[model samples]
Every structure is written in structure tokens, then in C-alpha cells.
Target: MGGRLPLFRDLLPRGLLGRSVLIILVPILLLQAVALQLFYGGHLDVISRRLAGGVAGDVAMLVELLQRETIEDRSWIFREASWRLDLALAFEAGARLNAVERRASMPLLPLEEDLNRALEERLRLPFDTDWQSDPRSVIIRVQTPDGVLHVEAPRKRLFTATLYLFVIWLVGSALLLSAVAVVFMKNQVRAIRRLAGAAEAFGLGRDIGTIKPEGAAEVRQAAQAFNRMQDRIRRFVGQRTDMLAGISHDLRTPLTRMRLALAMLPRSADTEEDLSALTADVEEMERMIAAYLAFARGEGTEQAAPADLVELVQEVAAKARRSGATVEVVAPSGLMLPLRADALRRCLGNLLDNARRHGRLIMVAVDTVSRGEPGDEAAPAWAQITVDDDGPGIPAAGREAAFRPFASGAPGGTGLGLAIARDIVRAHGGEIALEQSPLGGLRARLRLPV
Candidate 1:
């Protein structure tokens, strides 16, 4: 059943006008061919009878003239007068007689043999009535005062000229119609192809210049809709970025004043703890605000270029080592890939910081992954970067909520790290998730599409 499904489900639309033309033209051609058959068939019937009647009339009249001429003068019998009359009459009637006979006996016409037989029987009228059933020839009998005279003329095929004419008409019409359909289909497909390319460019975040509203009305409407959507997205993103930048600028001034004021506190024994606590609170507040600002103004937002994945991981690991954290880099391939460099750095930095804060050791593993099974669905080629730690892993149920802003599993933690990391990754068109690691701690996985 599965093997047969493709044969049954030929579900992709062939095209609009192509299918429509076929629906229209096929039946039209069939009907025309049928009408041609019927019309020619009638012509054959009429022509055959007319030709046979004309011939019979000529023979009767000629015979009557010959008898009278012979009676008038004895020399007329030996003078070949009948032959001369026949030659003269035949020259005049040749075209009409041949046309009728050919139409009557045309094999291409419907039931030609039966039609010929009927014509022969009808033309046997006052000429000579004795017609043979298995006739290859026309047998004529004339009653005379002396005895009876017998004349025989072979039968000939009818309707050849009509068949040749009809064949030319049918073939010529089909060729003309097919040529028209081919030209029309080609033009339509070209327009559709242009629209498809424009759509793909838009999806890839490239600026598509004004789309020409060509083709059918539906296609034009779709292009117009796409243009509107792109305009809206650009406006919204611009406004949001401006707002975030303004807020960050306004906030730093107060935090700077607070830091200056905290420095003026006395270092006395009785009140040292309270002063230290207050200073610590100020620093934490400043850190949280800075994190918020960083999240707001995402890295590489203004620029993106290709970078080497394995080298970037190694650089991050080196930075963590300098900061007194145990981090290792593992990569299967040294892949140079296109990415927003600063955004990727910020995402990886946040993960490394989180692991250092909560775990004994950090493992940064990088590899290429095929995200699904091979056959039924396409296995997407993706870069899989996993940051794992050796500590108490995040609980299964609570892992999903950890990426939300202000969601903290640890005490004295602001919970903005994972949230900011996920945001940065998403902005770069990648996905990040938390799962249990083999190291008995949280595994942060980032999958980036190529």
C-alpha cells in the first residue's frame, strides 16, 4: 500500500491554464473529429448516388440517340457514331462523375461498402435494372424490339478527393492549436518562476526590490502582500532597537552615581558588614542592568559574516580558562560557517559563565548533526554545539522554563544569563535548549542551520 501511494497521490498541481487548456481542447478536438466523420459520411452518400445517376442517364440517352441515328441512315452503324458521342459526353462530365464516384467508395468514410451498394441499386433505375449481388462490375440490360443488349462497366472507388481534403484540415488545425498552447504555457511558467525566486530572496532576509505586479491577479495580490509584510517588520524592528538604546543610555548615569557614592562609605569594624553588603547590592544591581542592556542590544545585530566554528569554540574556551574556569573544547570538524559573530560569542559566553558558576567542570562539544531519521524525512544538516557541566542537572520538568527572564533555579542568581543567551541565539536564527547531560548536570544545546 505504501509503495502504491505515490501512483495514487499525483497531488501536485500541474498548472492552472495548462490543465484548463487540456480540458477545453481535448474535448473540442474529439468533437471536431467526430463531426468531421459525420459530415464527410453524408457527403459520401450524396456524391455516390449523384455520380451513378448521371452515368446511367448518359448511357440511356446515348443508347436512344444511337438507335434513332442508325434508323435514319444505314452508314451511321459502321461510322463509330456511338463511340464519338460517348467520348464527347465523358469529357464534359469527367470531373463531376469522378468526384461522386470517389466520395461514394472512400474507405475512410463510414460504411463505404454499404453506401456504394445502395448507390448502385438506386442508379439502376430506367437504364438497365439487372444488378449483380457479388458485383465487381455494373451489368446493364436494355430491352429491344429484336432481342436484349447487355453492357458491362467495372465499378470504381469513390470519395478519395474528400478524404485527402479532410486529412489536411484535421492535421492543420491540430498543429496550429498545439503551437498556440505551447507558447502560452511557456510565458505563464516564466512569470511564475520569477515570483518564486522573489519569495525565496525575501525568506533569506535579502532586500528584494519592488516586485512587478505581473501575471494573474492572484499572483499580483500575493506579491503586494509580501511587500506590505516586509515594510511592517522593518519599521517595528527599527523602533524597538531605538527604544532599547535610549533606555540603556538613560539608565547608566544613575548606576554610575550610585557606584561613586558607595565608595565614600567608612571602613569601621562595627559597621563594616552593613557597608560591604550595601556595596555588594549596588554591584549586583549594576550587573543585572548591564545584562539587560546587553540582551536588548544583541551582538552582531548590525553585521554578520562567515567565521570558523572550531576556532571560535577554542577562543571561548581560552577566555574561560583565563577567567579561572575549567573548560574543554571538542570539535569533530573545522567548519567555516556564516553567522553573526558577536551574537554567537555572547550566547556561548553566557553558557560558559553559567556552567562555571554551578559546575565542577565544563565541556564544550561541537559537531555536525543530522536532526532527523534518514529516509522518511530529510535529516537537516545543522551545527550542534553542546555546553555540558558536571553538577546537579536541571530538573526535567523545570528545564523548559529556565530560559525565561527572571527564572532562577539557584539562590542569589538573577536568572538573566540563560534568558539572554537564548535570545541572542534566536536572533541569529538558531535554537537553544536545556537537557540533562551525561556529566550529571545541565546540557545546553544550540542548533544552527546552515
Candidate 2:
């Protein structure tokens, strides 16, 4: 039984809605089968016995009349029985009875045993049925004094059309009910589909709107819970960002004041170098504060829209070129993605700036790639953006450390560039991976879902 369970599971539907409908449909089908079995096995057997018994009495009377009659009288009886009772009778003078009954080797017809039992009790003679020969009628052979008495009776005397009607009605009603349930379930599950789609969009940092509760009671409760969760998460992120923004603003005030006071102080020739160094330290602090504020504020609630990803990457490459960085771009035209243009631009800007700062030569490649089974025509596509440069790449061991904010690794960087870029990429339902470039530097592979 355990071994067969997997086979049954494979036969079952794979979706929630399908499985739910199957839960309703399977029982109806099984019950219909049971009802059919009970009808045919018990009730129909009794009816067949009663029908066969009446026909047997008529066959026995005809047989008795023929046994005691002259040739002419037997001929009249055969004609009368054939007309009135749908019995075709013939006398073959020298035909041998089959040693084995046809029923022994043939497929069982409905109530075949009942017909044989009735005939054996009434006729009291050796007989063989032509179960193979006729379809619309049954031929009963009885060995009598005359010869082999051949009696051909309509098969309906033993098997009527009611059984066939019962099976047809049972199957047709089940099909009708299944179809109705499918349509009804589709409507019922619509709310669940909406709930899932809304949750997915929220995870990807898209706008989450108010969801109206629908479906069954349990399903409505789930939708309500999701709505509450969404509200709570938005509130939490908003509170943290607000707190950090306030902190970042307060920290910048003293650093700005210190810079102003230092500029105002009269510098001696001996102290000139120290003043410049102190000024540079103040500026670095300001930059760090700015990066922290940006990270805290998050890419802002940027609305996603369809934009040309190729154009977006080229724009970043163009900006890099303007900044005296050697930039090369290879991209297909008009490759659009549903994304936040500002957030993605900021992400690409950080990655490009990082590459240009480390390496003299930089390359940005953008294309839409399909991810699915090989040769599948309906595969979904991904927008791939890769930034490669000839700088000294971070080691495999330190690669993960590069994305941490203010981690001590690089000499001049605040260590927030990769972290900021990752936050933005993840918000757009994309992934950023760092690997050793073929150009002997860092390769930033940013894959965005289309």
C-alpha cells in the first residue's frame, strides 16, 4: 500500500484549487461507482432472475409440446413461439451437443448464470448456449427426441436497456458536477491568487495597495492577516528610517561647524599641512554621514515603470565616460524592464563608480537572457547587467565582506558603495553577484527579473 501511494499522489492534481475541487469531485465519483456496483450486483441480479424465470417457463412449455407432438404440430408450435415470444426454433437432426458450455470460455454477460439456472431447472435436458454466435439474441441448444432443439431468443429477455441507462446517467451527472465545481472553485480561489500576487509585489518593493478580503472564511482571514502584516512592516521600516535620518542630520551639524571654525582660524606656515589634513578628515566624515542617510532612507518609495534597461545602463556608462573613466558599453536596443528608474540608476551608478575608481578600463554589458529548459519556447527572460574592469579584484574570501557598510578592507572607500547597490538591486527583485572578472578584476553580475 505504501509503495502504491506515490502513484496515487502523482495522479492527484498539483494546485490548491485543483486539489480542493478534486476533494469534492473524487467522493462523488467514488459514491457513484459504489451505487452502480450495488445496483448491478444485488438489485439487478434479482430483476434478471425474475425476468429469466418467466422466459424459462414459456421455453419449457414449448419444449414439452414439441416432445409429444407430430411433425406438423411441432412446426406450428415453433412458428407460434417465434412470433409471440421472439423465440427462433429449429430442429437439426444430427448435431452433437458441445461437451463444454460456451459460457465456460466466453466473457460473462449480465445474469448469464441466472439464465442458465432457470433453463436447467425447467427443461431437464442437456443444453449448450451459443454465447459466441449471436449478439442481439441468445441461442439455446437443447438435445431432445426430435434432434438438437435450437431456440434463439432475443438477448433483451435476460439483459434489458435499464442497466445501460443507469450507467450513462451516473457518469454524465458526475461530469456535469465536476465541471460546475471547477468554475465555482476558480471564482472562490481568485482571492487567494490576488493575495499571493500582492505579497510578491510587496516583497519586490513595489507599491502594495489595500486588499479587499474575499473567498471562504479561512481565506478571508488570511487576506486580513496579510494586510495587517504589510501595514506593520511599512510602519517599522518608516520608523527606523526616520530615526536614522534624524540622527544623521544631528551628526552633520557639529562637523559642519567644526569645518567653519577651522577655516576661520589663522593658519601658520608650519601648521598649514595639519589644517589641510584636518579639513579632509571633516569632509570624509560628511561623506560617511551622507552615505548613511541614503542607506537609511532606502531608495525612497519609488514607483516602478517600464523603462529601457539598455538605455539605462548606457546612461550610466556615459556618465562614467564624462568623469574621465575609460568606459565601453555593449547592449541590445530597447530591452525594457519594469523597474524603478531612479533606484536602478543609483545602483548602476555605485557599481560603475566603484569599478572606475579601482580600474582605468571599464566595460558594461547589458542583455536580456532566458532562463529555462534548453529549447523551451516559453521560457521567462532575465535582464542581465555586468560591470567588468581591470582593477585588482577582491579575493574570494573577502568578496562577501565587500558589501558590508564601513567594513575595513579598501584604503580610500567608505565601504558603503556595494552595500547601497545591493539594497537597490534587491528592491527591484534582482540579484547582484561579485566574481573574478575575465579582465582580471571584479565582475559585478546584476540579474533583474523581467
Candidate 3:
């Protein structure tokens, strides 16, 4: 039963709109089918049988009348039967009923069965019905003691038009109800779709603003909740950024004063080496302060926009090359995706800088890849970028810890490079990870949705 549940779910529609429509249509169709069975299967059957019986009774009465009347008078009887009973009759003298070809019965239609049963009960003689002989009539040949009697009964007499009318009414109502359900459900689903799209864009650091509430009461309530959540998060981020900016200013001022004091210090051969070491320490402190500020600022209020990732990778690679690193880039001409350009640049810059600082040979490559099951067309694709180098790579166990702030693994490093990179990448709804590179060093991989 558990295994079958998955198969049942797989057969159902995936979208809410489709499922909603199915929810409405299934019951309606089933009801119509039941109504059809009750009406056509029961009431219509009785009506058909009655009508067939009346026709058979008429044919039986005419056969009895012809047997009693003389051959000359039979022409008048047939003429009267045509005008009064709506039946055409012809007498075949000395003709055998066995010679007439019998037509195949239509099992699906109850008309043939009802008519045949009625004729058998009424005539009490050998008779065959030809439903296919004429479209408008059913040919019935009866064996009389004198000869074979040919009777053509109007097909309409054996069935009521109410059967067709009932079916059409059922179908028409079902169609009308289905159309109304689709229109109403589509409007409701549209509102939900808008809410989802807005949430996705906001997650990717694109400010889509608040979405207007529409649709049902529940959906509207959810949208309102989402708007409230967005407002709260934005306000929180704004407050944090403002606080960080003030701290950066206060810290930089003291560092600036310290640099001036160090510059004014009297220099001598003995103190020169100590002064140089002090200067390097101050510079390192400044670098650490900058790294801290960058880490705290994050993507920094940058709105996402469509940017060519390939061009960005090449630009970062060119910058790395100028900084005395041998950088090789392999990427397609254009791979555009929504991004906070400066934030992503910083993210890539950090990865490349780390590589340049540790490794001599740097390799950058960008490509598109799918992270879904095989043959899944609707699976999302990502723009994948890898920065590889020939430097010493971090062990797999410590790679995850390297993303923490102040976790530098090398000398002259502030330890915030991987942390800042991961922060920026996550802000853009992407991921950054470190792995062993083919170049025998660390590989920093970034994947962003395309």
C-alpha cells in the first residue's frame, strides 16, 4: 500500500491549479456517470421496451388481419397501415422467412434487444430484424401461414429522443462547471505564483518590494505575512549595517592616528629594524580591519541584476594576472544571471587572491551545469565557476572550518577570505565550497542559479 501511494501521487497533477481542477472535475464526472446509469440504464430501458412492444403489437395485428382478408383487399390494408400506424408493409406470396438474410445484432444499443424481445413475445412466429437495411427504418420479416410478411417500422418508434437530450445536458453542464472552476482557480493560483516569484527574487538579493495581496482569504493572509516578514528582515539588516558603519569609522580613526605616530618616530640604525617590523604590524592590522569590515558589510544593500558571469570571471582573472599570478581562464562567451555585481566581484576576488597568495599557477573556469536527476527538464541549472591553484590545499576535515571568520590557515592572512566569499555567495542564493584541486592545491567552487 505504501509503494502504491507513490505511484498514485506520480499519476496526479503536480500543480495546484491542475489538482484543484481535478478535485472538482472528478466528482462531477462521477455524478454524471451515475446519473446517466440511473436514467439511461433504467428509465430509458423501460421506455424503449414499451415503444418496441407497441410496434411489435401493430405488426402482429396486421399479420393477423392479412391472414383473414382476401389477397385483393390486402392492398387497402397495407395502405391504411402506412397512413395510420406509420409502418410500411408488403406481402410476399409463398415466400419463405428462411431466405431473408439476418443482420448482426448491435450489442451496445438496447434498441435491438428490446425490439427483438418484443417481437418474439407478440408474433410467436419466426421473424428476423434488419437494422442496417435502412438508416431510418428497422425491417422486420414475419413468417405467416400464407407467405412471408415484410414490415418496415420507423426507427424513431423504438427509442425516445430524451436519451440524447439527457446525455447532452449532462455533458454541457459538466463542461460549463469545469470552465468556471478553471477561471476562478486560475486567478487564485496566479496570486500564489506571484508571491512565490517575489520570495525567490528577494532570496537572491533582488529587491522586488512587497507583493500586493490577491486571491482567497488564506492566500491573501499568507501574502500579508510574507510582506511583514520581508519588512522585519530589511529593517534588521539596515540597523546592523548602520551600526557596522559607525564602528568602522571609530576604529579606522584610531588606526590612522597610530600610523601618523609611527611615521613621526625618530629613526636610527638600531631601531630601524624594529620600526620596520612595527610598520608591518600596523599594515597587517589595517588589512585585518578591512577584512572585518568587508565580512560585516556582506552584500551591502546591492540589488541583483542580470550580469554576464563569464565576463566577470575573465575580469577577475585579468586582475589576478596583473597581481603577479599566472591565471588561465576557460569559459563560454556569455552566461548571464541575476547577481549583485560588486558583491559577486568581491566574492570571486577573494577566492582568486587567496589562490594567488598561496599558489603560483591559477586556473579559472566557468560553465553551466544541472544538479537534478537525469532527464529532468524542469530541474534548475546553475552557473558553475571554479578557481583552482597549485598551492597547498586544506585537508577535507578542516575545509569546512576555514569558512569561519579569523580561521586563516596561512601566514599574512586575515582568515576572513573564505568566510567573506561564502557570505557574499550565499547572499546571491549561491554556494561556495573548497575542495582539492587537480592542480594539487585548493579549488574554490561557486554555483549560482541560472
Q: In model 1, which residue pairs have backbone atoms overlapping below 3 Å? A: 101-158, 102-158, 102-159, 103-158, 103-159, 105-158
Predicted candidate 3 versus true structure: per-residue lDDT over 365-424, tens digit per residue: 999788798877789998899999999889999999999998987889988888988888
Clashing pairs in 3: none
TM-scores, each model vs. reference: 0.59, 0.81, 0.91
- Per-residue lDDT, model 1, residue 24, is 55
Judged by lDDT relative to the true structure, which candidate is superior, 2 or 3? 3
- Tens digits of per-residue lDDT for model 1, 1-450: 997888755753477656756765788699777977676767765776665555555555545554565433634532443354232221111112111113332234443454335435544433233334325545444444433434444444322366567778888888888788767766666667777887765553446666786666777787788778878876776677778778766776877787777677667898888877887887787777777767655542445578998888888889998999999888966887776676677778888988988998999999977777765356667788999999888898988888888888776577888888887666556788999999999999998876
TM-score quality measure for candidate 3: 0.91
Collision count for each candidate, in order: 6, 0, 0
TM match of model 1 to true structure: 0.59
Q: Pick the candidate with the highest TM-score.
A: 3
